[model samples]
Target: MPTEDHQAFVNELVQEHGQRLRSFLARRLHGAGADLPDLVQEVYLRLLRIPDVQTIRSPRAYLFTVAIHVLHQHRLNLASSPEAVDIAEALPMLQARSGDNPAEQVEAWDRLEGFYEVLGELPPKTYAVFVLHRQYGYSREEIASQLGLSYAMVKKHLAQALVHCRRRLDAME
Candidate 1:
């Protein structure tokens, strides 16, 4: 049972904030072959199920927050699947592009994967805060609130994580 007012509100939200939402997802999912329109549709679908959509004070920011969550869930699902193929399979055919070197690109990806593996060796809370802030683009304040951590603690953890990542990357280099 959908109310006309609610439908109208959603429509208004789509019209005003749709592009920004899509662009946000576009940047986060740059190499994942994620369709912006499809992601936007999924966001709207989730919005429809939420009973308190109208109560949100900043719908645009809320929409981006929801979209980020959706993207995170999508990545988790992909990572969880044993049969999932590597994203390199979806890269554009660039044989004709003079500046493109598939070998180098693949090497870089492997290095990044190794970097993430090193990141995983960190304590769970430290890794979680680092991933939420660095990978998922959550602010320190937002991550602290979500994880029930003090802001100073989050900063300290991030600083430590960054130093560790730097050392690891340097060694790799």
Candidate 2:
């Protein structure tokens, strides 16, 4: 059950916006284009699923929308698996943007304080797990070995850490 023009339309999308979509994903994905091709294929698969491709007013936005969802799934996978998530990658995201002014500095400090306050509320081992990975740049395997904990335990701790961080950040906002 193949539409005769479906392949043609998919090709058009790639021909027109392929580079732009890849570039957008590259920037969002830590500037690594390793997964760029796979993500693009996924985008095409999604686009082809639409019953009518002609109905799309802005294919560029549609492509971006799918790409972002794909990126989100990638992040969620990272959140669950320490081997994929990098603390350095998370740091910039966590940092509060500050203007070049004393007032902005004060606000940033306040946000930092709130973040630390939330971290402090976590269970001791869970907090330690986060610090080991983020501050020490320890792999989850290394953290597990250092703490004499199981891999599953390390993953659980990371999940707990992420949930707590998101909850507090949302509340603060």
lDDT of each: 0.64, 0.68
Compared with the true structure, the alpha-carbon lDDT of candidate 1 equals 0.64
User: For all the candidates, what are their Cα RMSDs to the real structure?
Assistant: 14.5, 12.2
Model 1 has how many clashing residue pairs?
Answer: 0
Write one digit per residue (lDDT tens) for candidate 1, span 20-84: 77776676564765566677788888877777656876565456556755765565445335554
TM-scores, all models, native as reference = 0.49, 0.46
Model 2 alpha-carbon drift over 4 Å, by segment: 82-173
Candidate 1, residue 111: lDDT: 62
Tens-digit lDDT string for candidate 2 (41-141): 88788777788877876565566667665654554445445543332212212455564566775676557546655765666567667867876688999
**Best by TM-score, which number?**
1
lDDT of 2: 0.68
